[model samples]
Target: MQSDICTIKVRDCSYIDIEANMAIVINNCFISTNVFRVSPSVASDEQPLLSYSHTHKKWLTGRYIGKLYFEYNGKPHCFEVQPRFGNANILILLEEIFNIKLAHNTSEYKLYDNSDNELLKKIISIIWVKTLSKINIHGLPKHKVEKLNKSSTVRGKIAIKRSVLPIYKEKYVVSKRIEKEVDSTIVAILKKAYIILCKDYSLTESMLSDAVKEVIRVPCYNKKVITTNQFQKIKYGAIYANYKEIVDFSWHIIQHKKQSSMHEMADTMGDALFLDMAEIWEKYLFTILKKCFAPRGWHVYSQQYRIYQNIGFERSIIPDIILEKDGHVVVLDAKYKRMTGHFSDYDRTDFFQLHTYGSYMESHNKKLIGLGLIYPLSERFDKEKLDKNFAKNLYGDSTSNTWFKVDGICLKDSHHQLTEQKDDFLRRVESLLLI
Candidate 1:
């Protein structure tokens, strides 16, 4: 027996000792700690008996009395064993070590001491070969892997695969920065050109189109300066007065993706219409006061008192205008509606509201000169008779002494002719206050 040279798998001989001269070469071996173990121990007396005896006797004695503790991977175990070196004994030992019974389907092996070192060397050699074979150089230093190509490569070609690898990528970043600068410069030039053209030609569609094309040719400039729909919106004051025409013209240049629906436009148009009418009336009123009352030293602040009551409930009331001069407070509420034959609940409510303001001022001992509800001309009541009736209704006939007097003033003319009536109303209010 040439030292009974035999190789065993690394798993088979997890624990083994070999002589230094007897070489063990492990190849491709994954060396890791075994999760299972077998503890072989003998009684003190049995140990002495085996130590003192001859080789065969020691073997026999050890086999007879030595205890083997089998601990499977991930499990705790203890057992007594008759330690023998036969194949059946080895199978039994392995079965106990792994907690699996030996069957005809399973293969088995035994490792003598001489073969242990050679098996280890074989394992180490195999591991070294595998590790070296798996050495990847693609992500390593320049000496390891070839440098990627920088020349612009077509799709599906493996050039510089990473963004950071190509020189053109840096060039692309630089080009983008240059393009942005150029675009900004172009836009500034275009804006200045547009302003110059607008100043010359008054921003008509043809002129605007020619101006834009002079800088950069654009399609659809010849169609219309202002769209038919946009013209209607501007004429009707559907948008703000200042920006309406300009915004409409801009819309023609850059068409909106979604135009406002008829319903949305109508709602917006209603507000615009009211504001337009309100502006007209506001101008008329200002003119009337300036012409009629300015000479009298009575400064009329239109839309003046926005009353906010802080003590009781949070209440807000805004009188149309407050005509004040020389310590007289003339509270005027403008009613667009005409006075009816029998006063409607709304009319009475307006009266009560004004009366409350009057009462509040009187109770506070403040100088509430007089309160007046001004309405448009009505067929139900004569203007002079209505004024007297309004005064009698507010202050009872010789029965009640209200601190502030409430009266109605009817203007027969349109807002443009309100100057004449405003003067008369101011004089009446002045007389009532004895000023």
Candidate 2:
């Protein structure tokens, strides 16, 4: 299944009101004004919730991805969105996110190359093409074993289901199910993918048409049995080797089930689609930190919980990234936000959070702990100043060589190229921690 992002205008930005029925999910970056948060006339309990406010019209800015259902100027609307991250394009960010997340390159990697077109349609086309190519190379005949018909040579022992085997002794009851069954989980995924792609509008992929035609002939139904473990093995089939990411991405789209309807497909066309880019950045950075640190004999743990404070209610806190090697520990909180050119309350709050984490980890574990803010480098900041933005700051302990430090992770270097960004970031991080 491909994802579609909806574009909309709040039409009446000056004034608006809301009721309890309609809902919307906007990234924290997006404005909380009444125009930005709209509500629908119909009462749909399943809509994503949002707070309403009346404010002036302005450009929409938010990298958080999620679905929204609302009404503007008397008409209802539905959208699946991936909003831009600052001046950066959303699709490119998606490419970076997924590449880092999957950490594997498939033959269909080129599917993400074209950014000027519809992402969902192109992805659907690529999936169809890649799947058909694999099917052609390996042939569609799955090794389906049968117990009756006496049409093919026996591949299994004469196994029967009921006690009436005596009468049908001549018929070898092949109870063994091998890989060739059309109803196998892989084929079920394919059928489901086909239906999902079919529901998309304005598909230009010619192969998609052929794929849909042949999909109807597949002797299987969309059983909705695709599981996490089942998905991991689907790509290992002889033909799917190069098609791994495409199929895996398709699985991602399929997972977004409608809360209201079990049988309904993901809202790719107009109604439903979205992803949390904020959560994604935090998660992906954690993954990168894990991989980069592991090779250096550092152990990384994500969402490590500790008792920051304990009232009668027994509340706890979780840090996004925690790394330990020998007797040294690094506590980090990932922020998927751009720098404000100078420090603000946000930075102060973040520093306080990290300080709290360092104290908690050090006191209990009795190890030298350092705190860091991991943030993406954007075009708005002076790299030199931003790099040393923590120099005069309260966070940093050169005396003990462990305290608060600013990561200033450059997503792109002076050359403005992203290709070398990952390695450069890791090296910088290593230097920052090992120092």
Candidate 3:
């Protein structure tokens, strides 16, 4: 017996067509119009329609002509379907279909622009075909497929959990520790810069009144009582300018000549001398150190500052300067050398000497945290290895004095540039003092 004919219903209509054309089957009932050609249009110059018999798939209708509009799922999508020679028509069939308007000058005249269709297809494919199966199944039989699915689910959950948890807490802790160390180092360097300035300028506490007045005026001070520019003027007029005068006077005494008037020579000498005196370390570094550290409550001391000690060693190894703030000490020794290679056994010995200062502080109940070795700008030293060696030589272990450290700072051409302006010097000093 022949199989019972099955009828397919669309919308409110039923259709039965044995015709080979799928379009005829679709349109004969749903569309209710026999005269209309419901199949997609093609052009005379287009290729013949190719078909797969087994899969019942229709091939391109000739080379498509004009634009083709169709509905897929619930949305209207368009493709540019054009023959080698013809006007394009947009096809729109679905209810609530979206319209697309293309410019006449579009380059692809043969193919209907299906970019939007492709984009929708990709999104739908990913959602339905790719990701849908990944949804969690709360309960399942203990079959292999179920077990494998559960394992995948657990792995994804663990990954999400790790992503949200505390992997970097230790890194943050280390960073904070390093920052504190840097701050402490800066405080020490600034203290030393201040001492250098005071000694070089022969500045007493009373002498510092004018400098203080100028210092308070700086913008960083943030006080209406003084401006940085005004304070700089006072400091320049008092300390740095006077040093310039002394240098000029000394130069004039050395270069006496009959042709040039001594007064004229003195005037020329004064400019040169000022330039020369400004190049001095004590003048520039101290000013910079003061400006850099004073705002942070760091005190710099140079030269005459004394740290008396008896660490079973008879003689005191007085450092060039000591930077101190809130009871923390940073011993800084300045070296005037051309090449950084001059770190001799003597220099190493001197470092050991400074380590003695640290030992003294530890023994005598003082809060000595670190030591700094300051050199001219061109000099470079390996601070890590130096610190390691220092700890080993002095404390008998590479890490014994973990808190006690050594660092190097370079004061290059900043002295010459900074000495001319008190404020500039202070700014540079502040930067140099940074640990």
| Per-structure clash totals for the candidates | 22, 4, 25
lDDT of 2 at 153: 47
Model 1 earns a TM-score of 0.32
Tens-digit lDDT string for candidate 2 (1-435): 233423342311112233223323332212211111111111111222233433323232333344444443444444334433321333334444344221123443333422222443444344354445444344343444454433234444444553246336654334333444543665666566566655541234444445445644667644657777877655355554544544554554455322312423223223333334455566557767876788888888765353525656655567777888887788778776545454531457777877787777777774755667877665433457546654422344345646556654555423245535656666756765763
Rank order (by lDDT, best first): 2, 1, 3
Model 2 regions more than 4 Å off: 1-62, 65-69, 72-89, 100-183, 201-252, 255-257, 260-269, 287-293, 299-318, 345-349, 363-369, 380-384, 391-400, 409-416, 420-424
How would you order the candidates by TM-score, starting with the best?
2, 1, 3
Against the correct fold, how does model 3 do in TM-score?
Answer: 0.28
lDDT (Cα) of model 3 = 0.31
lDDT of candidate 3 over 73-139, digit per residue (tens): 3333232322211122111111001111222343321233232223212221222211112211211
Candidate 1 RMSD computed on C-alpha atoms after optimal superposition onto the true structure? 46.1
Give per-residue CA lDDT, model 1, range 1-435, as digits (tens): 123223222111012233222211111111111001111110011111111223223211111211112223323222122212222333332232223333323222122223212222222122222221222111111111233333344333353335443455453211111111112222332343344334321233332222234333422223333344543433312222322223332332222111211223222211000001122223333345445566788766654233454656565555555566765556655543334444331457877877776665456454556677654333324466545445533455534333233333333323333434555655655566445
Candidate number with greatest TM-score? 2
> After best superposition, candidate 3 residue 113: deviation in angstroms?
81
Task: Tell me how far the alpha carbon of residue 118 in candidate 3 is from the true structure, in angstroms, after superposition.
Answer: 84
The lowest-lDDT stretch of 10 consecutive residues in candidate 2 is 34-43
- On the 0 to 100 scale, the lDDT of residue 227 in model 3 is 27
